[model samples]
Target: MKDIILNFGPPEELETKRILEVRSLSYLERLERLMAIIEVSHTLNTAKIIQTKKR
Candidate 1:
């Protein structure tokens, strides 16, 4: 544990993790928006398929 701290330092690693989390937040939000768009597209496609099948 002491060796690991000497190698990387505890506070530095924590700060790096905090910075990474802050940077990834926007990417996460973009992914969420993409997922929502895909979900809606899938629903529309299913409705179209069902309508064609019924006709």
Candidate 2:
């Protein structure tokens, strides 16, 4: 779980807290996917901040 999720909080939203089973993914594969998601999220946040600064 540590490799997949950087931060966890109390369940409030069903979509964020939903559980899924991925039986085929190796530990490394899961980490890679998590990293990809983190990168994408970071990129999106940066873009949003830049747009705000431009205003």
On TM-score, the leading prediction is 2
Write down the lDDT of every candidate, Cα atoms only. Answer: 0.77, 0.74
RMSD after CA superposition, every candidate:
13.0, 8.6
lDDT of 1 by residue, 1-55 (tens): 1143333569888888767855767777768867999999999999999999998
RMSD of 2: 8.6
**How many collisions per candidate?**
0, 0
Q: Could you say which candidate leads in lDDT?
A: 1
lDDT of 2 at 45: 100
lDDT of 1 at 12: 84
- For residue 33, model 1's alpha carbon misses the true position, in angstroms, by 0.1
By summed lDDT, the worst window of 10 consecutive residues in model 2 runs over 14-23
lDDT of 2 at 37: 97
Give the per-residue lDDT of model 2 (tens digit) for 1-55: 4466544666654345444444456898779889999999999999999999999
